[model samples]
Structure formats: C-alpha cells, structure tokens
Target: MTDARATPPPAEQRLHPWSWLFVLLQQLRQFVVPLLVLLFAGRRGDAGDFAEWAPLVGVGVLVMVAVLQYFTYRYRIGDDGISIRSGLLQRTQREIPFARIHNVALHQTLLHRIFGVAEVRLEAAGGQKPEAQMRVLGLAQALALERRVRHRGTAAAAGGGAEAASPAGDTLLALSTAEVVRLGLVSNRGMIVFAAAFGLLWQAFPERAAADWLQGFFREAMGYAGTLHLGWIGMAAAATATVGVFLALLRLLSVALALSQYHGFRLSEQRRRLTVERGLFARLRTSVPPRRIQAWFLQETLLHRWLGRRSLRIDTATGGREDDPRKLRELAPIAPPEACDRLIAHLLTEAAWPPPRWTPVPRRCWWRLFAGGVPWNLLLTTALAWNFGPWGLLALLWLPWSAYAAWRQAGRLGYAMDARLVAVRGGWWSRWWRLAEIDKLQALRLRRSPLDRWLGTASLWLDTAGAGAMSPPLCIRFLPQAQARALYAQLGRMLAARRLRW
Candidate 1:
C-alpha cells in the first residue's frame, strides 16, 4: 500500500491566520442588528434584568456560535491541488486541481487596509464564477501562495520539465493611465446608463414593489403609445436628455473609481495566454489562456464612433454554468479594437482575414422582413394618420428605416477568408465584424431554401468554439457553386495545416 500519510503538503496551500477576520466581520453583521435592538429596547434601567442580563445572554450565545463556526473552517494545499473545508452542521468540501487553474486574483478593501490583509480569488477554467474568492489573507502570504500555485500550474503545463522551477517569462499586459482611461471611456456607456438608472430609480421608488409596479407601467404605456403622442413625444425627448446628463455624471464618477483602483494597471501577455493585474485598494489579478476564450465582440458605440475608438470584449468558456442567468463576467475591455489590431493580428497570425467584404441576400428574401406582423403597424399608423394628419406620417418612418435596414443587411452580409483567419461581417448601418481563427472553428453548415436554390445561392455558417449561440448563416446569395467549394476547401486546408486539436 502507498504511504499516503508520509507525504507532506505543499507550503503554498496553507490558509492565512487572518482568514478568520472575514468570519468575524460577517458575524458582526449577523449579530449586531439584534444586539442593538435588544440592548436599547429590552433595557429598563442601567442595573435592570432586561438591560444587563438579557443583553449579556443574547450576545454571548450569538458570539459563541459565530466563534464555533469560524474555528471549524479550514483550507489545505497539496501537491496536486487546493482544498477548502467549511460549514458547521452540513460540512462541505471543495477541491480544485492545479491544472485547471487559470488566474489567481488578490483583493483588499479599505477595511482590509486597516488590518494589513487582502483577499484571494482563484480563477479556474471550469468554475461558474470567474474566480472563487476568499477574503482576509495576509497580503504577503497571499502573494507568495499565488506565485507558488501559478508556478505549479505552469510546470504542469510544461510536463514537469526542469524549466518549470525557474520563473516563466512575462504573461501579463499592463495598461498606462492614458490607455486605461481611453478603454474605460470606450467600454463604459452601458455602465453609465446602469448607474443613472439605478440612482434615478432608487430616488423615484425606494421600495422594491413600488419600483416594480412603476417599471411595468412605464413599459406598457410606451408600448401602447407606439410613437403617436406629440405632447408625450416632447416629454420623452426631455426625459431622454435628462437621463443622458445624469448618465454622463455617473459615467465620470465610475471612471474615476476605476482609474483610482487600476491606476497603474498592467497586462502581461504570454504565448497563448494573457494575465491582467490591476487595482490599488483591492488588487485584482486574472489570467486567461487562449483555449478558454469562447467568443469576442468589438463594440463601437455612438460616442466611440465619434471619437474613432472601439472596445473589445472577449467571452470565456469557463463561466455560465449556474442557474442564476444574470451574472456572467466579461473580459474587461482591453483597448480600442483598432488600436489593438496588431495584437489581434498576432493572435490570429495563423489565419489571415482578406479585406472587409460583404454580399447582398437576393431580393426574394424581402418577404421574411415582414415576419413581425404587418397588420398592427399598418393599422396603428393608418388610425393615427387619419386622426392626426402629419403626426400619422411619422408612423411610416419605420418603413424607410426597415427598408434601409434590409438594404444594409444585404450589403453588410459577407464573409472573407485567407490561409489563417476567417472574417464574418454582418448587420445593417451598425455593423459587426467577427474574426475567427481557423484552428478555433467548431462546426460549419450550409443551408439553402427553395427560394435560395431558385436564386442560385446558399448561406454558409461557421460556428466557433466560443460563441453563445449559432447565428444566421453568412448569406452568399447568387454565388457560383465553384466559388463556395473553393472557399470551403481553403478553410479546410488552413485548419488541417495548423493540426488543430478540435
């Protein structure tokens, strides 16, 4: 039998003594509320039974339980992995393998500053959260532990070679203040809207039920109005402007906060990997290996377009495994996509995208555009125009917009490929361009309807490993069969040349 007990644990796996501080803090919140109420309300006189005896007993019991729970918690680090054990009655144990580890992030709040401690969040490739976080580790110990684990991870990847003992070359990227600021501005419009909405809604309806009711009412009213009321139209315009102002202020504050924390941010890039280490108050570090990246989105908002900036968002494979659908961590914006095109090019060096190219869907597909139901819009507009003259003409605005959309949709729908990369560009006036390396391609599909056949065309769809859902085909309508075959053969050859695993 193997002498399992004889083997010693790795030094880096131990938990810091200050880890108890988190439990202590949590206990304070749980018990303090009741303690305050009892101490004040239950008390009669200074020496009375209600004041002295009751307060003492209640607090004593709560503190005892909290202490018990806190003490029971333990964590361990072994040669193969890290394990955490916790819980008072129903004990829970979790083990994470070093091989699956992605990034080890460190954090410290202002409160943590007082205690000279920080938190550790382990980013793993298969976890629900981007990182599994635990608070109140001694800062130095946490850093040492992070280094050890990360080293171990690297060693494992290299097949336990001698080189693993030595520190690996840089695998992080750091952003300058200017760069961080620019990225923040480009990526923060949604955050601005969120903050403003939060502030305004909190002010308007402090209670949950009231807010819910108001939100529902607003949604229904907007749907019913359907661009008809001139009086409300003016009010809506003013409200939008007001919202915009509030959002701007909120965005500025948010940017300031982000800048303060990630003031001297750095990102280290490695072969097939990236590690982002940032934050001042609560230092954050996250690493991403290339294989974990699920999808990439390039955002160009109205503000970004005006500034000629673009933001890049990358989705990872390790997240999105939980019942709570709302919470998912996105890759923090790296840079304006155009600015980082060189990096993008390097990453996609194995595959090259030709030029920005698009093709139009045949005119036969125009009937599908009215799938949203023609009667409602037509009837509503007719009634409004009959009742209110020029106001009714406004309803027809959607026609022009829809027609323009279809035209742009036809114009914007195209795909281009070279030996290394494939580019899919789609959408109308607001276009989206997706670049996928041949190695990452998951599946391919070819679809042709009766109409498409009659038009002598087919839509080609490429599924990449990281996409959320499969999109509509890359419609190459009215193309020769020879051209389609040639494109497919080129992509196949590229994939084969790279010896892609999947």
Candidate 2:
C-alpha cells in the first residue's frame, strides 16, 4: 500500500537492464545439474572431450536465447491492465485486464536482491501459466504494477481512499524465530527434499535403482560388521542408532531451511486485499483479495498438537504450479489456535469459525471404515509371520491399531453447513478441516461404491476451483442413503441460482 496521490508509472517500458543475465541464470539452473551429471558419467566412460565441451555449448546457446528474449520482449503498463508483446519470428501478444488478474507476485533471489531487481508474475484464472511474467524489473515498478492491478477499474473509484492507509497496513500474522522452528518440527519438508533429489537422480540415471544400492549396502555392511565379532543384536542396535542419527540430521536441515524461507514472514491486510511477504535469502511478496480464495484448509498434525500450533492454507484461483514462488499457498504456516480463529473471522466474515456443532457420521460407518482396513491388516500379518517365523507375528499388533484408528476416524468424519458455507473435518491423530463457501463450489458428486450400495450408504463430494489433482476434495462419506441424497439435493438447489465465485 502507498499514498493515493502518487505519481503514475510510465506506460511503456522495457525490462531491467540485467534481464538477459537473469534469464540466462534461470535457463542454466534447469540444466546445470544434469550437465554436471552427464560430465561425470562421460569422464568415467573416458569421453573427456565430449564431457568438457557439452556444458560449454549448452551455456553458449542459453546465453544467445536469453539475449534474444531481452531484445524482443516489450510491455505496457496501463491504468486498467497490462499489455505484453514478445517473440521475433512468432510474435505473441497478451492483454490482461487488472480486474481479471487475481494474483500478483514478486520474487527476489539473493542475486536479484543484490542487483535491486525482482521477477514479477501476474496470474489470472483459466490458464496453466501466468498471464504475464517479467523476468526482471525494478522492485518499485513491480510494486506499482501490483497496486495498479489491485486498484483497477470500479475498485479504483470505490476504494481509492483506502490506498492512503499505512504502508504496512494491519498486521494479521507474523512468525517469530521460535514459531518458524516449530513449523520445521511440524513439517516433513526434509524428507520431501531428500525424495525430490532422489527422484531427480533416478530421472538422470534410469538404470540406477535405490533397491540395488540398499541391498548391496546391507550385504557389504553386514559382512564387515560380522568380522568385528558383533552378533545380530549388536548389528541391529547399531543400524537403528545410525538411522536415528540420520533422521536427527534431516530435522536440523529442515530447521535451517525453514529459517531461511520464513524468517521475516508477515501477513497483513490492506485495502481489502491480503499481502504476505516472506523468505530471507530469496524473498517473495504476494497480494491477493479474500474473494480469490476458493477453499480453506486447517491442519493439525501430532507435532502441531505437541507444539500448540496449527497451519492454514488456501486454494486460490491462480495457477497451481507449486514450484512457482509466485503462488501464495500457505496463509499461515504456523499459528496458535486463537490466532487461526481470528484470521478466519477476519477474512471470511460469513463463515462459522469454530462451528457451533459437529455432526458425526452414523454409527454403522464405524464398521464400514473398520472393515475396510481389516483385509490389509490380515495380509500384512500373514506375510510377516510367514517370512520371519514366530517373531514376525508382532505384525498382528496392527489389528488392534487399525480397529482403534477406524473408530476414532469414523467418529471424526462429519460435515457442517449453514446457508452460506460448508465444512468437513476428518482424521484422528493428524486432523484437517476443509471449508468453502456454498456458492464457490464448482461441482457436487454423490459417490456410491459397491460396499456403499450393499450397505445402503452414500458419499457426498464437494469440488471447488483451484484444487490440485493430489489434494483431496471435501468429502462427507458414509451417510444413510436418504440423508446423503437429501444433502446433495439441498446443496444442489442452493447452487442452482447462484454464480460460482471462482
């Protein structure tokens, strides 16, 4: 937010002078590791000249392409929208109105910060890519563009005075160092990072399987450890200790990364829009109005409960590219229960925050949920007992665990709705609450599995915009057939005359 009477930005402009350098860096990032891997493989294979020349040629081509982009791209920032023109041989043009642009983000890596420039992305709905992407721009100009996009057309007339509010606006949430550390503890980000790297390695070297390395490692290590006169018990203990140490190291790495990414995390509200600025070395700043939020997720893991913290996330109408720093996914990475409640109240005034009451699924669903996992339990126990003699019969312990889990989970499965909003909650240990406005839902499906048909039960699924393929939708499962049909019909009637928000 800034002064309402500020001078207007220039209509037409080129990207920052260092645009080519940033573009080259971005291109090189995607191929640098792959080229290095190839070089290493080639050297091992005794192809020295090819190994050395390959990276050189790749970098040269990337440089030429980056330079060409810098010379060809041009854009105009107008009062109502932005017009972008690019390409030489196949010139492509895009005109995005400010009203249509739901998200505006600015990204600054360590190098960009040093150079006083940022990458700006403007994203609208109904696209797999951002509407406009400026690889490099002065930070001030980028912020100005974001402001213009926010206060555009009719909004400019109605909310022009709100721009004069304090530059920082009203602080909604801010994370302290301790809170960030708690977030690291609650998250499994270290494992995610390790898995991503392992997947990348597999992509680069298809023949190299993790099972081969692990099997060979255990065989060799067992033989060597046996030579030291340590029996099976000692080897088991040592291996367990090693694994524990490795997990500890991973957690420490996660903490370090969390500190870097969310060190200065702050979320604030200004002129009816929410702005979040975070990251230490690679800063990201994004702004979006509450209306853009399609769905809300409230999560509390075992660790979150232990630390007295919770996380809040939202699905927005912008493109669902998690790799893109421009997307604002986590509204609150970690906060106390009270703060989360306040946040929900502030942003979604119409929705019930704590929900006056919760309706648990029918008692018969407990048996349904419990029976669903029984076969897997028996299969696991049978396989383990067959492989490990009497000792592996410990797998039978899973039977009681699954029973209790199903009972607790079925007790927790429920949905609550008012005229304007709908919410569903699930899970026992790692619980989640999913909510969306009644009018914002894109689709409603009534699912009936074979078991459901046999038992005369049904499931109702609520689909909303901005949800990814992997993210589970709001599902209220295992209800009496008549009740499920009633809910489906009632919600359908409510959705009939109203236009979807996203």
Candidate 3:
C-alpha cells in the first residue's frame, strides 16, 4: 500500500455544541404527537396525572441522553475515508472507505442556519442508510470535509492519490424567484399538504365528530342547491365552477410552498458531479455523480405546456431518508423546454440530445387502454342507471370519450434508443420523456399477460437504481411482440458489452 493508504486516521473529533440542541429538537419532534394524544385523550384523573408528569420525566431523560450522546459521538477523517464512534451502553464504531462513499451531502436546518453550522451525510452504495453522518460542524468545516471525500473518491477511481486541486465547473442552471413561483403553480404540493392536514385532523379528532361535520356540510350544500331549482345543465355548470374554484385555491397554496422551499435554487457541475444548493430557511447542498444517476425524467403537465415550460428530475442511487431534506431529486423545477434540453445536453455530453425520430407503439394498444377502464366505467354507469331512469343514459356518453382518450394516449407512446441512451415518451395528462444510459441499466424484463399474448403484444420494463417508492420503472407497454423481442435482445447485448457503473 502507498504511504497515504497506510497512514492512520487522526484523533477523534466531537461535534459542535449546537448538535445537542438539534438532537433534542429531533427527539421532541418524534414524541410531540404521542404526547399530545396523551394530554388530550386522557379521560381519567390518573391518566391526566400520568400525562403531566410523564412529559417532564421523559424530557429530563431525553436531555440527559442527548448530553451523553453529544459527549460520546465522535468521528475521525482519514486519508482513505471517515470513521464514526457513537453509543453509550452499547458502543458502535463504523469505518467507511472513500472508494465506497457514493455521495457527501451538506444540510443546514433552522437551528444549523442560526448557529452557522451544517450537517454532513456520507452515503454508500447498497446501504439503506447513510454510512456516516455528523450532525453539527462549522459551515467551512463541512464544505472542506465534503470536498476532501469527493476528491479522494474521484482520485481513487482514477487509480491515483488525492489531487492537490479540485476542478470547479461553471454553473449549469439556476432558478429565479419567478421561476420558483411558477414551479409552485405547476406543483401538486398544495394537494399534498391539504391531504396531510386532513389526515392529521382525522387522526386527532373523534371519528364521530368528523363524520358528522362532513355529513352536515354536504347536506347544507345539497339543500342550497335544491333551493336553486335549476335544471341538470345548470347543476353540472355549478359543480364545474365549484371544482374550478377549489383547484385555483389549491394552486395558490402550492405556489406559496414552492416560494418557501426553493427560494434560491441553483445547480452547478464540478468535474463529473452535479451539485444542487437550494431551500430558504433550511439550506441543503447535495452532490450527485453522473454514474449514480439512474434515469432522467422530463415532465410537462397540461398547465406547463400551456405556459411553454417543462421540469427535469432525476433518480440517483443514493437512497432517501425521511429526516433528511437533502435527498430531493429535482434538477430543474421549472424551465423552458429548450433550456431543459440544453441543460440535459450539458450534463450528459456523451448522449445525443433532441433524440432522433421516436418509434410509435402499436395502434392496437388503444384497445388495451379502453379495456382496462371498462370495469370502472361500467360500474359508474350501472350506479347511475339504478339511481335515475332514462336520464341515467347520459353517463354512457363517457364510454366513447374515454375510448377516444385512450386512442390519443396510445398515439403518444413512443421509444427511441441510441448507443449511449434509451428514451421513452408517454403519459396522458402529463407528458413525460424518460432517458436512461445504457451502462446504468440494472435489468430488463419483457412481460406478456394473457391479453397481451392474445393481441400478440408485450411490455418491456427497465430497472435502474435510485428510483423512489412512488416512481415507476421505465416501461413501454403494448409493443408488437416481434419488435419487443428485437429491442429486448438489442438492450441485452448493450448491457452485456458495457460495464455497470452504479
């Protein structure tokens, strides 16, 4: 081994004193809900007594534990990587090598921001959690540590010792306040927030009260509508207006959230890694190497299309944790289509941009789409017929409209592949163009269901690391069996020839 590799790690370093505050805050957040439940739901005097003293005792214990943890937790940086030692009763020590470090992220929560400290998280491949993390360090210290880890990893990959200098690349993209606001306008964050609030309320309040309130609210609404004595057409128009108003309010909320979370978003490239710095009150710095990127998704919703805007997101191999705010995968939240295309070209210079002619999926896929929706629509029509007489047939009109929509969606399904990248384009309400590098593909699967077999069609699925629970795998459905087989073979050969990167 070289002298650098043989060098022992330096003495252990303790976190900043502010880390105790952060730890205390984390524990409080974890216990707050349960404590509130205990306080509010306690019916007996003994229960109330327990709730009162339990929090005090629990808090005291937590403070003692946090203080102990602050003293016990220690980390050391070595030529190879980092080592962490923690725990009170049961000691735990972990050593991570630079070669295995996939990402080094920096984050500043409200407390960290106030104290000018940052949290450093070191991620490794194939691990569900961060390999090593330091809760509190001076901002400069955090940045230096991140730089050192990344430099060591890169140099090791190139079969060399650490370089004296780091390569600084130009900024690739930055979001303006206006653009961030637009992102909020196009985001569904408002719906998400509203749903979360509703769930919390449902959980906290008695079910009887919630059900009664909902029933009363709907009854009053129906009563008011009955007083209008309007025709069916008028009723339809009123319902549409109400829905439109609700959507407008939701969009406003979404914009407000976007403004707060992505106030000064910026993306830059350094060497082969992409760095993202964003957030308002709680800043986050995330770095992702190109090799760790699994796929790129270019999304354009109907609203985005109307505004001539698009958004770019990526999936990286670095897994996500609920407590970490630095794992966000958005590249460009909102930008013009051309700008997004340019950014993608800059990021993946090896891959061709504005891909060649897309091969359309078989037209027979429309039947598949239509058949998939048959059961749901049929049930709706039946319910309407049971409720109303001849007027119920109006629901049948949805059948033809739904079929036409399926046909239109089938027209949008297309795929294109080159030597470096494979691109798939599809989506009905929200158009998406997904791209994946050939060398990054982990697996490829061709599936044929009974219906697909009868129609002589198949579906192709591509798996890559870094996909989230909600993110779907890259897939193209309803392709001709012969074409699917050929493409499958072609991808298999490409995957075999290229070495896996992530």
In angstroms, the error of model 1 at 139 is: 2.7
State candidate 1's TM-score. Answer: 0.66
Alpha-carbon TM-score of each model against the true structure: 0.66, 0.87, 0.89
Q: 1-502, model 3: which lDDT tens digit per residue?
A: 5787664647888988888878888888898877666656654446657766776777888888888889999987777877889998999998888777777788887778889898888886555688877878777677767777767744432211233223356688899988988899889999999999999999889999999999999999989999999889998999999999999999999988898789899888776678888888888888877678888889999989988899998887886563356775788889999999998898778989889689899776787788888888778888888899777778889889889888888889999989998988887877888888888898999999997888788999988876534344588778889999999999999999889978
- Candidate ranking under lDDT, highest first, comes to 2, 3, 1
- lDDT, candidate 2, at 104: 83
Deviating ranges (above 4 Å) for candidate 1: 1-8, 11-14, 23-70, 87-95, 126-132, 153-263, 270-272, 280-282, 320-338, 353-393, 445-461, 464-466, 469-502
Candidate 1: residue 171 lDDT (0-100):
34
Q: Which lDDT tens digits does candidate 2 get at residues 1-502?
A: 9999998774667898899999999898898988787777877777768776887787899999999999999998666777888998999988888888888888999998999888998888757888888999877667766767777744432222334322447899999999999888778889888889978877766455766877899899878888988687887888899999999988987898899899999998877788999998999999888898888899988989999889999888887485665688888999998898899988888777888988888765777767877788778878988898887778778778878888888878888999888999988888999888998899999999998899898999998887643255688888999999999999999999899887
How many clashing pairs does model 3 include?
0
- Model 3, runs deviating above 4 Å: 1-9, 37-43, 47-52, 153-169, 220-242, 321-325, 387-393, 468-472
Which parts of model 2 are misplaced by more than 4 Å? 1-10, 31-58, 153-167, 198-240, 322-325, 382-386, 468-470
User: Evaluated with lDDT, which candidate comes out highest?
Assistant: 2
Question: Which pairs clash (backbone N, Cα, C closer than 3 Å) in model 3?
Answer: none
